[model samples]
Target chain A: MTATDDRADAPAASIEDRALALLARTRRWHWAEAAFWLGAAASFALLPDSHLLLTEIAILGLFALSLDLILGYAGVVSLGHGAFFGLGAYVAGLTSIHLTAEPLTGLLLAGVAAGLLGALTAPLLLRRATDLTRLMVTLGVAMLLYEAANRMAWLTGGADGLQGVMIDPILGRFEFDLMGRTGYAYSLVVLFVLFLFARRVVTSPFGMSLRAIRGNSLRAATVGVPVGRRIIAIYTMAAVYAGIAGALLTQTTMFVSLDVVAFHRSADVLLVLVLGGIGYLYGGLVGALVFKLLQDGLSAITPQYWQFWIGLILVVLVLIGRDRVPALWRRAVRRGGAGA
Target chain B: MLTILIDGIAYGMLLFVLSVGLSVTMGLMNFVNLAHGAFALVGGYVTALLMNRAGVPFLATLPFAFLIPAALGAVLERTIYKPLYSRSHLDQVLFSIGLVFMTVAATDFLVGSEQQLIQLPTWLQGRFDLGGVAVGRYRLFLIVICALLVVGLQYVLSRTRFGSRLRAAVDDQRVARGLGIDVGTIFAVTFAVGSGLAGLGGALGVELLGMEPTFPLRFMVYFLIVVTIGGTDSLTGPFLAALIIGVADVAGKYYVPQVGAFLIYALMIVILVLRPQGLLARGR
Candidate 1:
């Protein structure tokens, strides 16, 4: 048949029609988004008594999300993100102790300090491509900070850390209670606001540029993206977020320890991101929840075996196919449908 | 002043022993094994346990100390590291970190959290007078052993077939593979050897620095700084970097006690900024 005749006879759609159809088919993602938010809100509301745990999860979730910005979006692997976190916490603690004792002011100071530090360090740290070099540079930075903190005992309180930090109420209303009721609410609010901001940044044109850079920096640079500038900006943003999270932690606990910048804290943040799945914004929050829950539950059950079990979990996660969760969930849904 | 220099040299030697293996693996395989320090800790702990608990002679325990960490490294490579080699650096990092946690936790469970001291044998215990300066015999022996290892490793890499293969693999894995060399075997063998060296360093250096459960985290930064500043792919870089860092660290601790703690990191930053490729580029 002639081409025109064939086209007339065949009930085929145009490219635009196909595109529209595909968009319609994928619109159900909106419902999935709604379900996720609803579940999160419900969980938050229902677990009112779990303020301590929830607050911790909130702060850590924010910290992990900050890491996700650089690692997941910008392709910078750091083992020293905790430096900013610890710096923020210490700044907040010192501010509260020696300055105004206001939580909001402390957090703002923390974020600004951390952001400046990240900006300053980015030029040198962003010069490397190999992950090993990046790891060492970041670790060295963190260790340097740790040593400075220890040596500057008069200012940082050394190994004792900045203790007895008393934070006043936010806006002179929400006092931090011993039960962590106020702390949980404050952290949750801060986390949600930051999440919203992060979501905006990630979905923005700038964030798309970051994703492009992450996928292939050489190609992105060839395509006219200023790779260095994007990296520095994203790195600074991540550091600021980490700082806020750290401030939240110190303000909530009313104490700041050198542990904030410790190696284990860095490792823990990495673990949470991995457990939650990198590259997804929700991954950090989910990973934090699961990790905190596991840590809390396992520690209660067997304090000594807590790390052992966590290590086992990490090992199993690594070995049993890192992408098994989505695959298994899909399979389970199919199986349920078939059974029904 | 003389004593500080002597102490710095001895400390530098110990650092060289711990960092050289890490430098080789980092240079050759491009593997970031965070568990490298864990092996060192294992070596120290095993040596200490044998000597302190089992009543084994200090000299006799050396073989066991080296062998135990070597076997551990081999087993770890087979089970955990092998799968991670081809994965992304992030995956490898996470997996190695898990390995570190498991090793540390297991060690803590098996042994207590208390620090264990390594008492040198009588012959290695006393101090020797050198030019009116009395230096510890153990430190002198450590310095000598470390020097020998460096010299021997340089020779092996320069002259031997295995070393040649390793150098080839490090320089260009794809080309080495094209040449029909078993890249996987080379990687495994290199990792084992690297870990064994870490263990040896740990056991030998225990007299200078006691072993503890927190040893991995405590010294991981030191080794990393050396490797980073010296450049990862150069064997001689870590050696030279270690000496600089060792001297700087000891002198900083002694003279400028205020900023002494952060001297190494400062040195690292300065070196990295000045020579980003490290002090030594990998030899062709």
Candidate 2:
């Protein structure tokens, strides 16, 4: 490592200087990333009929991104992230009904609500516990929320779901239409802005510390990384991101339901993050696109039994291997390099 | 109140039977299996199919329910689940969930989405007044059968050579293997037996829990709750945990119908917060 680094940079460079340079290198945008976003923007005109689907994908992507922040980077495994997402959706819906039709304000309020809940629950997760305990706790919390929503029929509309969640359009100009053109644009903009922020967070030193903590919390703690505090901060931040995504869902559809807080929502987001490849910000977006498209195609084929096919896919994917994917990708790349 | 307690004990016993296998696999193999309920579903359906179609008596069909799922579990463990033992918890969870989805959908397609009915014999039907507390004959039968099964299981696990080997393995795989124990064979047998027990529980629970295509998805959380609360170390923990959950659920539903599982979920979270290892985790 020192030999290669000496040729590329100055031999006298300090370890800290070399580390800063490496961090800077990771922060730079790749050509593929620029093209990815460009393609997403182009979809507005190219796939005009699919805006509704695109909007769903965007919201799902953001939700998956929130999960990735904790699971991938912070090494926290959650089976009930839908709690925050649902909380955000319900809060946003209620805010719209009782307070304001302004979209962004509702989004902010929803985020704050979710964030506060996250802060309250974050300590519960910070305790020394096994993955099983964490999974059960998170799932239990979500189930409690689901029960609350079900019992509070008057407020949350019970099983019937919240309705009449009307919203004013972006800056009171562009309205959410039947075609979902405005909704798609709004969602995409939010996704892109959030994605940029996530990208920055992951590339920074804070992100490095998170990765360190994930690798070995004990070692990171010994190295003075403030492991618990960092985990709480990231977890809370991820909750806010999820909340915003849920709020976006409520705003776009103008509805919120018990399904938002359901176990399946959490499971689906985890699936999306895993499918895209964790630890990377764009994994969520790519995964969301693939999962959404797959759902659309499969449901069209057999609406009643589409889940069977998805199950088959998951089984096959795991059997074929998942953790080995990066190694396989590298091997293919190396072979291409050899051929070149 | 006594009736509720009796009913809760019956329900809890059924839960212990259903989830004990999950506890075995999860505790011994350290695999996060979300599809454990699928085994129970298969057992329940086996009973439902035989009783409804083949003129087979409900009592006679119980053996087939146990054997069939046990055989299926043995084969699947050998073929599909063997490699996953060493995989990460996430992979295990995904694999099991996939299995669950496939099972649920397949059941839905084969049998209509409607709930399956198991025809109980005249002997197992109706309520019997036992000392002033009116008890359903079926519930009483369930309690007796489940209690016997639990006793039988406790005896097998505590007294037998196989049980000792299994315990050694759960302590440390490497050390157990070094001592020349056939951990693989033990695990396969345990897995099959666990699955068989789950099936039996499912078959017995047909009158209570109701057999449906979405059975696995509906009851996954309950099974998990039992396992997590009970801890995987001993049968006693899970047995007691299942009883607590069953009683809490029955009483909660009976008295505060409006709460609808809120109490149970809250209880699980609280227990986990206080004892993250479980109700009866051994000190390391």
Candidate 3:
């Protein structure tokens, strides 16, 4: 009730108090968000056979969410986010094969590994540069990693991909089965937990600083925000998110392929993020759901030539203008509210 | 070593011709046309189809290859790309990438996934030894044609009336428009010409780079590298960058084939880190 009640007392409140109220308002969960999560949970029971597909949606959603953190929130354009994702996957695969098969531990290791790589690479991305430069560097780094993996055939299994990955059960309870039920549940749980963490982070004061930086870095710097450091932090955090998503894929599928780090993976995730909408926390989740469904449907219709349609949709979407999409969505929502 | 250098120069020249068009579009309009390779693919396909199916000589098909993609580029510029010039870089990137995907899929559907080989005339097929450096007749022809193109492009860009107008347009579009320059037509023409050049390069490079449905996606990074490293301001930067990349790539492949494209990518990252703008970028 604090969110609803604070607006009534806003006029008399001090500047700090009003800021607190605004923050609280943003932090308040909407009914739609609750319903979405509830639906995700409900699907576990309602759509038992589609758990495998749902699991892919969950991982992709997380991956897209990671991209959203930088591209959507922080205004950083990256073309090779799959670098961290692939790294996480490769790390998880190696850990399962060479060390332990414990799922949580593998996830932790993957996240840490990706985070470290992100931290190391953050400086390279944080330099005074254009978006094109960022794209080339990010892409170049990913390609370098791909080539390295391809060369280190002894360790990575080369072009054939790293196989023989064995993942243990979730907390030593349920075993992974052929139907992928456990995988879906496990991935969903990880996604939900991470989503909560991301939501909390984005709603905080630091997140506001990121928004300010995104809007105008020069002005943000003049306002006493450390633009460079904030970018590095958010980028590293996003990398961890992507890495965790990759780790989930490896854990569920028990195989890591070169395609994980392929250029298409990066492009696909970008498309998903764009489809779901950007900036908002739920965009990735929504986008992943829509993208996966679209891919499935399109492939079903024309397995080989589905990319043409996907490309057509992207072209049409952009031609219509991404800026117009939110306006249209808002209009529909307003009309729906009136009907309700 | 000499043979590698010759091959490298030939490869570099081919890359320059393919990527120079991209540099102009990116520099002048600041539009990130990631689908530039698609134009090249069209040219390559044109050459292959003409040479194989129609029994046309390779030389005759080259003009059609250029003209067709040039027309395609002009139409696309006026219709699809013109509106996007004012959009954000992200939008431009996505739009072009969409074009790339469409072209790739469409090419695959039409031609199948196999690489298309263009039969070079008998005269252009054989290799000759020049001062102990073995050189293919096709490669030498490529180097000669591309070098001529570079010279011609430089002359057109620097010494011609249209070149100065294009330069004016690139420098300050608003001012150029105020000074009675039709910026839109200039852009459309430049874009078409760039696409035509790319087509020519694709036609010439089929034997060397190979032609496939995924041609755009495969060589996209290389084209981007040339533009970024060459600096989008002038023709010389991309030309030089292409040559450096060409030689380095050839030498790298020859000396340490296992390392593959890793060295070139690492070098690009280092260069970008060192000079964020480019190797020969003009002062803003």
Candidate 4:
């Protein structure tokens, strides 16, 4: 509000600011670690027969996390994240069929493919677009890809889906088993590693710049943040994450279908992320778990009306408050803050 | 070619009626309601259920389609949508999408997941051949009804005191309130009419678009395309945009039967990129 005092100067003041920033950045949030351990420990011990569901949850968590990167931190709204996810799955599926099936390499390749696609499309997408514009553009891109895949059935297997996807043993060591234990464990490891990487990124200086941009893009630009470039970079990075999530799904399931590229994937992930609460690092993970569990429990009871329940939840969530449900961990945070 | 044009016009007219109310709410109220499609679905189901089950005449069922949804919409607006006028677009999208999901599920549970058939009256069933081309009897009916609706809507929106007040309210809520315009009532009425139009469109379009539990999700893109591409401010923009889209969709399907809806989607992307404010929005 005070424009008269605006100045970036004095080496001593800048150094002191840097020191303060470093201390604030390095502050440890206990809940994130708590969530990781709780998910890893509880799922394995409790649901021995639910490896497949757990694996799916893990993959979805990662996908939701990717959405959080742009939507929560960078203020970029995309409605077609499933494009990268489907692309990653298909790319990884093709790689397994046509190249090596090393899990890490496939994931890496998927991430790169999605990232490259994001980089190429973003300039076109980000051009003079607002919320509604971005939403439509993202959706348009996804639909275009979907139609292309459907038409090129020989390559994408069309509606029949890309079949005969056989992945080799991870690191040529642990073989994928019938019970899906290996898939669950593999996905858990990937989730943990990526979660670590994301934690590091969000806690860094660049992440703070993203928050500033989200709060006020004009002010951020005035303060020397390259707004367009940063948005593009984060969008591309989110795409890579989504791609990797897709790659994980294909690897675990050994199948890639047109459904992977559908609008519901994007919508579902967004729902899960927001359900856990936007902007929090672990929101995606927590949302994925709760959403999957709800789906499982509700579907078992009223199989035909499961969607109705989900819809009811959404209406209630919106009506009551965005911060009310799914993010139960907030209580812990609040209680901790109060105690301190 | 002429048949495609006719078909496109009819189709586009249907899109306009279904979505114009949405345009009013979105443009004037500045609220994004993705649940607009659900109103259409409700209308379609109402028409189908009454006509098929109760032996009601199709014409008699049309009023129910429009009125029932309008009533429901009015109630919903007063209750849920009022508070969301100030929320972020993301929240609005989520809330509406959730409603859509519930509506879809509820419809599926109630009516079964099978496609609801609209048995049109014999008078509107057959094709009317003009020169060498055969235009659908039902499509002609659609064009007439939608055109009348458009004229009525345009007249009410542009020529009526209510219209000016509504527009004034949209331009500035506080100023309109200061002028003693009941903005809330205007919005509620508009929301009802919009939902009613969606119902009428749904009832009209069931045969063309196919009505299943997933109708809302499927034709959502088309409705959004019409609204977004047409621009936000005026009815003519969406009307013209809908016409072009209808023609494009019909032509695309006719010529490249294998390509399906790819052209329309691609065109939408191009239009959106070129004119983010919409094809007809005046520069701010």
Candidate 5:
């Protein structure tokens, strides 16, 4: 036998190569992603006037998306991201009450305040890769901020949170109605606009650098990524997103609570990200939808045992595996096609 | 002054008990078990349930309290943790956070949301006059138990085979495996032991701080600070760090009532800036 004939026994190299090539080609399917987002946005707009739940989902989706930016892309796991969110909410509430009646300006103030805080804390948090240490430090910063807000009751309205945040008409046209129609529209607009902005950011050179850092910080640093500075910038930007989301919630609801700063809130946001999948931007949106639906449905069914069910679901997710189920299904489908 | 010192010591010892397990897991397995506090909560709830609902004597329920959390820990390690041990820190953190939520929810479901009170047995109740200073006998008992546990742990870690295996595993798991040690079993056992210690701390601490649904998240920060400052692996590190924190916490509360609550965070930030490796660099 000739060398070529002998190499034919080398186990279908071309088949494997072809499969890998197909996978590589399908990996960058942006059209499918765009279609998915469009479908989600359309469905959201079509949802009836369920003001409280819809508004909450919108705001939380934004919050989760903010987290997705840093966590999914940048790989910075923050247990204190709520600090920015809460800070933004408080800032928005305070500004609307004390400074400007304009809801748009309130949102701007929130993002700016939260972004600045993120920038300040990023220096300290960016120094370590020890997840535990980072978790603790970020958590500590949040606690400190919470304590400060609690102590400065005179300014923050303390535990009562800022009340009577009168948000003026959006650009002197759309008034925030109590039925939540206006609120939902406002949040939807904000979410879509921010989503577009975030989408742009993720596709930018900065976003590429973030992904590079997340993949391999040491290698990225070696290749002139300025890993520390990138981390700080991403963290700060995430804070802005989170802050805006928080402000949106307050503006929509016209009230804010110290619960925004609570550790549970932070933990819940992280949970949402995990449930939806962290690396994908849509993960946040998906997680928020699933979590909020589960929470609302389960709580309505059994208020006392709702948490138990939630916990059980989480444990099952962890035990059964996060990514295996989908992968297995895909394989099964492919095999079925091959057989056909 | 003596009271403050004693109170601080007692509080610190309790913190040390709760945090050492977390420190070991973080140091050895490189896993951030957020559910560490959940184990403590489990111990507290079980003990409280038995003592109050089951009408079991407080002293008698001690073994049940300890064993329950230990078993739970083993199950958690085997089922949940084993798979995630090799995962990224962020994933582990998320997994543990899930565990925490589940534990809290389960506890709340099993036991009512109302805070459960644990009455010290008649023998352990009340005060003992300490040369003109009155100290609670239970506090003294805790002090004694803590001291013994610390000494015993130090001895085990320094002299025993399991200790050596644990150290080897922490240093390098592949190398330890090459040396023929059952690394998986060691990990499970270590996790159980650590969890057991947390339960003990929880059971004992119930009297000092009542058992409530919010205890896990509320006390989580304090525990994290202790473990973080103590450097996650060294037994003495948590002990010493807890003392410093406990004392500082008390003093801060007394002097600066406004920012008193944040003193620990300030301390944590300072430590992070100065010695990010923790006060006593986690096990070499």
Candidate 6:
């Protein structure tokens, strides 16, 4: 709130201080990003048989990151982000089947298709609405897509799922093998590229405008910011990122299903962002890693009821601060140091 | 068509009861409780269990349905939900959604994942035709009970002194508290009564809407649709909204058959987009 007020008094700040603040806020967690990539690379070597799961984590990370773009930064709480993901997936799957089998082209096509949809849909949804109305609009759109997918079985393969999705080798190089090595590498590269782009997006002037809008849209508008255009831009971009993630999933897994657009996918991504903490780029990366591992570990013991444990964890996370896990850890460490 | 209309009205009535609690809580408390469906699930299970195992008459089990959820709502509101009253909508959404997941899994574990069916009493099993519209005897019973409940609720909310106190508390908690209104007690009671109504709806709806562990997740959208479209604050708004939705849905399914639930979502989006404050906007 004060930041927007400071906009009018911007010239008062020293050049040195402004540069330092920019650097501090924009590139705050370089080490965390390094750690994330290092861990991801290391996982490929350490766990020989877990490429598939690792690939899923990468996909989930991207999905959560896309959610983080609008929800984390722009303050637009969407409950139907999976719509873009599913659209990307179905597009990629259908493109490979009908148009071309090339991975990159299909991914690009998916992104473009989902982005266009977002651009068209954003105006209708980004109107002045309460949180409840926004949730309904997003959820309704997703459900409509889900229903369409379910009903259009003639084209989508309906309940049986979009089978026989044949994808070509990555850049006419490494092929998608049975153990998912190529897929893992491909997804990781895409996630990294998109993560960097997202990082750049969130730290730019437009990103600052988004945060301003999130903090106080009215105030931002009064301060000469184009709030609506910025929102529409970011919303479309987020949809594009989510579309790529969906395309990645379909390309890697070689399957497309209605679950991609399911409500739970949106919920799960939100959970990932929550666990990792929002408004930070690496929160999606860290949250996805932990959530996937926890799901895998917990499901092994109770395959049929892992949802209960996840639910329990979510409840605890909300009860405690969703973003305070790191703070709590630091506090405990400090207490131990003092006691010792 | 007439039969479908009657059936839709009955369905809508059931939806109003199930969703009215959610509308009330969201309007008064401004908390997004996604777990409202879970209470309805609880009530349905209670009624189903009582009828099946204890040989409790279908009507006899209804009271317990309301009582159990009301009691549960009271205890949970005090222990779990109270702290979240002042939290942001994000936190509230997350907490309530988590509650929904836990309750769904718990119910699944407790009462097997299979659908639970209730045996209607012999009197309710018959259908009568009135001038070409064949109305189920049980649907008529449901309509009568739900209509009466709606009237009772409207009376309590509009006419009673407690209603004014609750409204004042919702309008401005600090101001109401300053004026000597026990805001906390009113909230707890409202929440309990709301949950009880949801339970009653659940018990009655078991025959129309199948009861299972997935009940919460499956019908969560419908509950939200009713609450959001009807306007979060008013009783009649949700009531009318639910009727419109239920009728549109039933008629759409009856006529088209292929596009299940498509019409309702479309309608909800149109209504919400045009009237973001809900169909019945309160002048703030």
DockQ of every candidate structure: 0.60, 0.74, 0.80, 0.75, 0.51, 0.68
Looking at model 1, residue B231 earns an lDDT score of: 83
lDDT of 4 by residue, A56-150 (tens): 89999999999999999988787799999999999999888888877778899999999999998888756785777888888898988888888
Minimal lDDT window, size 10, model 1 chain A: A1-10
Better of 2 and 5 by lDDT: 2
1 against 5, candidate with superior DockQ: 1
Per prediction, the TM-score for chain B is 0.94, 0.98, 0.98, 0.97, 0.94, 0.97
TM-score for each predicted model, relative to the true structure: 0.91, 0.96, 0.97, 0.94, 0.89, 0.94
DockQ of 2: 0.74
For candidate 5, write residues A49-78 as lDDT tens digits.
566687788889899999889888887778
Best by lDDT: 3
Candidate 1 clashing pairs, residues 3+ apart or interchain:
B27-B233
Cα error, residue A112 of model 5, in Å, equals: 0.5
The true-versus-predicted C-alpha distance at residue A232 of model 5, in Å, is 1.5
Report the C-alpha lDDT of model 3 over A86-204, residue by residue, as the tens digit: 99999999999999999999999999999998888888987765787888889888888888888898999999999899998889998998899999999999999999999999888
TM-score, chain B, model 6, is 0.97
Q: List model 1 lDDT by residue over A9-78, tens digit each.
A: 4467874455445445433244445555676667567887888998899899999999999998899999
TM-score of 6: 0.94
Off by over 4 Å in 1: A1-29, A321-340, B282-284
Candidate 3: RMSD to truth: 2.4
10 residues in a row with least lDDT, candidate 2 chain A: A1-10
Off by over 4 Å in 4: A1-35, A38-42, A45-47, A324-328, A333-340
Q: After superposition, how far is residue A36 of candidate 6 from its true place, in Å?
A: 2.5
Pairs clashing within candidate 3: none
Candidate 2 lDDT, tens digit per residue, B182-218? 9999999999999998999999999899999899988
lDDT of 1 by residue, B101-137 (tens): 8877887888977888877778988888898998878
Native contact fraction, candidates in order: 0.51, 0.65, 0.71, 0.81, 0.57, 0.64
Residue B56 accuracy (lDDT) in model 3: 94
lDDT of 6 by residue, B224-251 (tens): 9998789877788999999998898889
